[model samples]
Target: MNTLFIFLLLSTISSTLGQESPDPVRDIDGNLLQSGTEYYILPVVRGMGGGLTLGPRSDDLCPLDVVQENLEVDNGLPLTFTPVDPKKGIIQESTDLNIIFQAQSICVQSNVWGLVEYEGHRIVSASGTPGNPGSETINNWFNIRKFDDHYKLVYCPTVCSICRPVCGDIGVKIDENGTRRLAISDVPFKIMFKKV
Candidate 1:
C-alpha cells in the first residue's frame, strides 16, 4: 500500500510538470507557433505603423535598436521564436523564450533581442547571445502573453530562480526623432505573430 501511494504521488507531480499551458501561441492563421520557425511580430492596432525592424535610435550605434517601420511600409525582418526548452516543439503562452532576428546586423554580430538601458529607459535591442539563461543573460529571455483576443510581448523571464529581473510589458516609445522604439511600459503593445 505504501509503495502504491508513493507511486501515485510521483505520477501526479510528473503530470503536473509536464502539462503544457492552456493556450499555445498561434500565428495569424490560427496555427501553433513551432520552435525555430520564422515569424514577424506585427502590431494589432490599425495605425501602429508596421512590424518590428532594426535601426539606431540616435547617432550610429553598435547594437542597432529595434524600431517600428513606417506606417505605409510593413517590411520588417523576420524573427525566430525559440523556447527555453526546444524539446517542447511548440511555443506555449507565458513560457520563457528567446526572440532572434534572422537578418544580420552590420553593427553587432548578435541578432538576439535583449533589453538595454538607453537614456534611462529599458529598450529592446539586438545585443544578446542565445542559450545562456542565467542571471548573466537574463535580459535575453522574453515571453508572449495573451492580451484580450490578441497577444503582447513581455520581459518577465523565469530562467533564473535566484535573479529578480524587472518584469514589465513591452510597448512602443517614440524617440526624440519621432522613431517608435520598443520599450518596457505599463501599456503593452498588442501584437500577433505572422508566420513567413
Candidate 2:
C-alpha cells in the first residue's frame, strides 16, 4: 500500500538524518580543547538524572567513583589530549584526543580497544580491553570522544568484567514498577566535565 511505502521512506530518511557524524571535539562547555588542559568527566542519563561520576581510587572491576553528580571538578576523573597521531596512543580512528588516566592498583589505563566514532555516540555493541601494562595502544571502543556541551558515553551491552575505564561500564536503570533494566545499548549516558 501507499502507506507502507511512505512509512519506509520516512524511516530511511530519519535514520540517515539522525545518524551521528564526527563533530568537532569540544570540552564540557562546547569549547575547543587546549592541548594538555585537564577536564573532569561525569556521567548523566538522558531526560532523567545525572551524577554517578567516576573518580580516582575506585574499584578495579567497575570504577564506580561517585554515585551522585557534584560541582566539584577536581573530585571527578580527569581526561586530557586529543587523538591526533597514531603513535601517540590515539583514542580512536579520528584525531580526537586520547584519554589520559592510569590506575596502578588494578592495571588499567585510558588505552581503549574498540571502534570509536569521531564523536562518541551510538556505540555499535563493542567491548573495551586494556592493552599491555605500560602501553596505551589498546584498540578499545572508548566512546569518550568530546562533543559540544558534554562528553558522551558509548552504549555497550557487554563491558569488561574485571577492569574498565571511567566511561566504560553501563549503569542500572529502574522503572517506576520496580523493573530493573540494564543500561546497555538501551540508554546511553552523556557526561560533563567541570571546567576550572
Compare the candidates by TM-score and give the number of the best one.
1
Question: Model 1 scores what on Cα lDDT?
Answer: 0.88
Tens digits of per-residue lDDT, candidate 2, 1-196, equal 9999999999999999997855555555657555456655555434444333333222334322222333322243344544433354323323333344322224333323233332233221113343332124333323454434555554222233454443443333443443222243344455665444
TM-score of 1: 0.90
* Winning model by lDDT: 1
Please give the TM-score that candidate 2 achieves against the real structure: 0.39
lDDT of 1 by residue, 90-182 (tens): 998998998998997678558888999999999998878797778888999999999999999999999999999989999999888999999
How large is the C-alpha RMSD of every model relative to the true structure?
Answer: 2.3, 12.4
Instruction: Give the true-structure RMSD of model 2.
Output: 12.4
> Candidate 2, overall lDDT?
0.40
TM-score of each: 0.90, 0.39
